[model samples]
Target: MMLTRRTITRGPFFWLSVSSGIVIMAFILLPLIQLFVAPSVEMLRVSIQDKDVAHSIWLSIYTAALAALISFFFGTPLAYLLARHDFKGKRIVEGIIDLPIAIPHPVVGIAILGVAGKNHVFGQLLAELGIRVMGSVTGIVTVLTFVALPFYLDAAKAGFEAVSPRLEKVSRSLGASMFSTFFRITFPLAWRSMLVGLIMSSARAIGEFGAVVIVAYHPMIAPVLIYERFEAYGLKYSQPVAVWLVLISLILFFLLRILTLRKTVEQ
Candidate 1:
């Protein structure tokens, strides 16, 4: 004669929540499923064999990897500093770090162009040194690093924050140097999250289009190539490339999920 909490949770509100969740999930997933399914096996085969597609995919992969590496080397120290210290203007610094993510992609491209275009100071300096930013792999990697750096930085900061300061203090008390303490104790504890962040940043770099297209239109990465094909030819020409990119993204995402799950299990 009495309804318990569990029984109450199964009422109309519960069903509504379930239905809404399903609809949201379907909204996100259906387009991806359609993209993967739309391309025929032969079409996928041909797209894979196409040199331009292959090259673009490779370019995306390697440039993204390079971007992730850059983020790791530079962003890690900043992340550790942010996590361990309280300083004046720290909030402003954090905002600056995150500003790229809030900016529109096309605007980011324009901003980078303004700073790094051949006529710009840094651009001119690089040019004098026989290096180019516009329309080169270096430019692509530069923009990729700009847009993707925040992901790794934020993740690494969170990871470092989660690690206890006491551990480092204990190591210091035991006669370890600051650098040795971090490398031996702190870094290993935080490495998994850093790895996840690197993967996410790499994925973001691989998919980046607007900024990268402005920086390096030639030697296209996969996303720019997809946009180019769609603009020049049509859906039919672009769909195969889209499908290929989607497949690779799915694979990368799947691996990310597996790593995350394993990390969870280990923790």
Candidate 2:
């Protein structure tokens, strides 16, 4: 009688768990499965061969990589400070850091243009330096970096926060210099999270469209090119590029995962 009653209670819970699992799997996995099934191999090949498509893909990769590098170089130190230090306006500063993530991309582009366009004071300074942001690679990278910075910063900050300050205190007590202790201890400990942040930033930069379009629509990235194709030739033409982009991005995603795993293991 006890076994029967227990089985009755567990049965509904088991089915509910199965249903929740199915919903999550369907939500995440179905779209990816469709992306593969929707495009023909020949269509994907042709898309890759298309000159404009090829250019967009290459540009996307180049710009995304550059943005990620910039984020890592500048963000690492800032992340450590934010994670380790407490000061006035700290909350405000953190909120500002996250503003990019919350604001609309088009709005970000508009803001960048307002501050950095040739006529504005900052923009005029840049103009004097013979650097134009209106319709150039600089503009694209600017927008990409602006939009993607928060990802790296936030992830790195979290990673740094997770490291016990006691460890640093102990290292200091042992007579190691601050710089030496950071290099030997803190950096190695937070390296994996930094890598994760970089991967996320790169992915965000690569997929950026609204801001890139508003900033520089000429030297198209894959997302822009995909949009243009859809506008010009409709779904049939665009789907090939879409499929190609998805496949290429997925490959990159996996490579980053492997890199992250290797880095994690090494540390």
TM-score of each: 0.95, 0.88
Question: Which regions of candidate 1 deviate over 4 angstroms?
Answer: 1-8
Model 1: number of clashes?
0
For model 1, residues 30-117, the per-residue Cα lDDT tens digits are 9888887888999999998999999999888999999999999999999999999999999999999999899988778788888876
Q: How accurate locally is residue 138 in candidate 2, as Cα lDDT from 0 to 100?
A: 91
Candidate 2, after superposition: displacement of residue 101 in Å?
0.7
Each model's C-alpha lDDT?
A: 0.90, 0.88
Q: Write the per-residue lDDT of candidate 2 for residues 19-136, one digit (tens) a residue.
A: 8988998999897787677778888888899899999989998898788889999989989999999999999999998999999989988999999886689999999999988778
In TM-score terms, candidate 1 sits at 0.95
For every candidate, C-alpha RMSD to the true structure in Å: 3.1, 4.2
Q: Best candidate, lDDT-wise? A: 1
